[model samples]
Target: MSLTCGRILELTGNSPKVVVACECLAAGGKTWVLLHERHGNPLASIDFFLKDGFHLDEVLGSSEYDFELVALQPGDRLFMKPCQPHFVFGYAHSICLDPAASHLPNINDFDGLMDLLSACVLVILGNVLDFRTYRAPSQDEYEKANKNQQILIDHEINSIPISERFAICYARGVALRLINWIRMCSEIRGPGGFIITDLPSRFFVQIAQTLIKYKEGANASKLDLQANCTLGMLTKQIENVVEVDLKISSLWSKRHLIPSGSLALANQGDYSVQWPDPGRKKWSSIERDFMDAGVTPLDRLCFDTQHDRQHLELSVVIPQLKSRSSASQHPPKRTKS
Candidate 1:
């Protein structure tokens, strides 16, 4: 579906809504859209929540999404799909884009895994704030119409994480802003709204830059605090790349031979084949863990069939009473009586 025009229209109408559609400028299948605030610096992409004191230490379904600048180019489009879930944190400036079909529906099986990871992050990063923010100059003219987009942020800070009650409280306030920001994304438009800045898919790139700073800063911290930021980022990356074992035992089964065949034809014309869905399946966490752990990823994808299927298993054990050269009730070979 060409979400370009209709999506843009939806974004432009009254109550400007967050749009879900393919990026017009991006290559057909591999683009996503994200909406973010543009800080003043041409290259500086900071969010208002960050400036207002929101610490994103990976808590409560909060993980920083990063993207490299090189990966994005001028006019590159972001493909937005409507079905993906977008959750707003406690802050007004931060918003998390949940797994969009794992971005690898054909390979990974990370269903329900993100939620656990989100929980882990929250546990570790106790002082995490809950809102979202954006603090950049408007990138498009449409945004100019609703420059007041910043108003959604309220000053009421929540009584969160009581440690150094005086230590600058950034998490909750910013998280609140982030939540409101999402609300605006789903509502901004027309005579008085978000204007034309649909979701900025490049938001990850901004987050990545910030994370780099977070890492370097940790290294230089005087307290030698064991920052869990790096690990949290990794988990988010894995979550993005891996897919849930969505089906009972199939990633578009027959799935077995489809991709292999595609590779075999490299010597021929451009590869082409459609992956069909296998029936529904239910797998446990242990099963998934076993499959992931057992499969040593190779240059070309390979599978340990046993992980997803049940076949005849063979094991031979000799009893203490059995003869040393035991046979299956048969005489020894070449034995002359």
Candidate 2:
């Protein structure tokens, strides 16, 4: 197809192939653009989809929604749908790099937002909400997606990078929508002959545990939801069994390393020591002699004469050195005179 000179310059690909233009298509529509840089290099781009798609006619009626992320480049083509059925062209220009792009709605958009949403939340919920044809997207899934979304929203509120902000919002929206369906499940729960069942039928059971994870809010506000069935609760229920790994920084300069086996190989110890519960910053000579600046919890430690493994294993009790007197049951030599 060709356009009149007054509208757009027609091209036969003789010299200038990069035409700065605009295009639009509906969801699942496709278009092509020619990009050949006369100078400089081309950069990679990511796509973000809108949470809602509009009809060309519908958008003409209202200007409320915005594209998620914008690919800032001239000679760039944004292939998108216009409303539901129509598709058109939009060309990316280099001028979009300027702040003046605020004047143009198509300048900077979030195309990656769509994939981010699908990966973080949609993938988890879509399979669970699958129905015969049109499955109802559940509230639980929506809530879970929302947790991912809130991070994006926070970025917006905090003036974070535009790309990150858009990605988070799409994720959060998916999680929140699934939770809506979960609410529906609770309202329609029926008994299975009063024997003990959560659903009306064993065959039609819901994936309740997985669904409940959606309700966990990213914000600390969800802490108030202690008794409620939510993702955080499930995490907390098994927190102890899932040992948390906490790393510690060096207490001293950490310039010195402890030796292994006081009697032998005393200078060959490797690794660091960590004791967060120590009440004082200063250490006695005894503590310093035994202290390992690098690693903690060695297999054994010296106690005057003998190496004691009990000292390393015991929690509160400090290890006492065994002596000839302590080892004997009774004292001798005092009865003579």
Candidate 3:
């Protein structure tokens, strides 16, 4: 099949190396396909649905590659090696792995992964900051606005500095790409296993701090306010992931080191099959480690001028006031007398 906006690569498995093409599909998306391609023969295809959501359907075109209509739900995955050509449909946010002609060495490279993650963070933040203008309004909404209103809206959107606009768009794109990478990593592991690692915790802190800095620097305008709220939510999500990873790592280190049978019994199940959910109280040491690694606290990172002023008044001004009052209560001694 002809490829557009997708990566084509040659991947080696138990069988001989073969080309793979992969594309991402948002909700309610479909792709056209050709049974044969000049790049390479189609080796395999896979679909991964995130959040236990969405449905995927596929239909084969050729009689030689006939297959029944199959539906895959959230957390449900489908894979076919030596895959036959077929038209694929996606009902939710999903990634499609197909045969391609080239190789992507950076896919597994640590530096490449870091770069991709950075790009995704930038995209997500940019989209959040200038969402109204970055994303076009729906047709229905566009039709409802009066001509004058529409012109005014457009003018206001255009008035935003070009530099800011570019920054917002770039951040949004990066965020999206990062999320796609996360989904792809999850899918590669197959079912009934956890992808345990400290990567998210290590990298997401910088992203969260960057968002906090942006939010803190933003003005009180409506757009800035909206962006700040959205960024805060995104930061919280990243923090949650980091906390969970810390918890799991702690448990894995402490519990998994024991004998297999004992560990299973202690966990009340297979240690590798499930992730341990430790309490929030257990996160203190991990938080300290993160701080040592230069991750600022979310509250401090998203500092507000008004809040800082209040804090200063309480800590510095109020204490001086109390000291003066106590001295006054002593009547300044009998010095005046």
- Which candidate achieves the best lDDT against the true structure? 3
Write one digit per residue (lDDT tens) for candidate 1, span 181-239: 33232321222332322111112222322444444444444323332224344334223
Q: How many residue pairs in model 2 have overlapping backbones?
A: 62
Model 1 ranges with Cα > 4 A deviation: 1-196, 200-205, 227-337
Q: What TM-score against the true fold does each predicted structure earn? A: 0.19, 0.15, 0.23
Model 1, residue 280: distance off in Å is: 29
Better of 1 and 2 by TM-score: 1
Lowest lDDT block of 10, candidate 1: 260-269
Error of 3 at 132 (Å): 12
Sliding window of 10 residues with minimal summed lDDT for model 3: 45-54
What ranking emerges by TM-score with the best candidate at the front? 3, 1, 2
Q: Which TM-score value belongs to model 3?
A: 0.23
Alpha-carbon local distance difference test for all models:
0.27, 0.25, 0.37
Work out candidate 3's RMSD over C-alphas: 20.8
Per-residue accuracy of model 3 over 137-219 as CA lDDT, tens digit each: 33232233446544533333222343554444344434443443344342222124555344333234434444454444443
Measured on C-alpha atoms, candidate 2 has an lDDT of 0.25
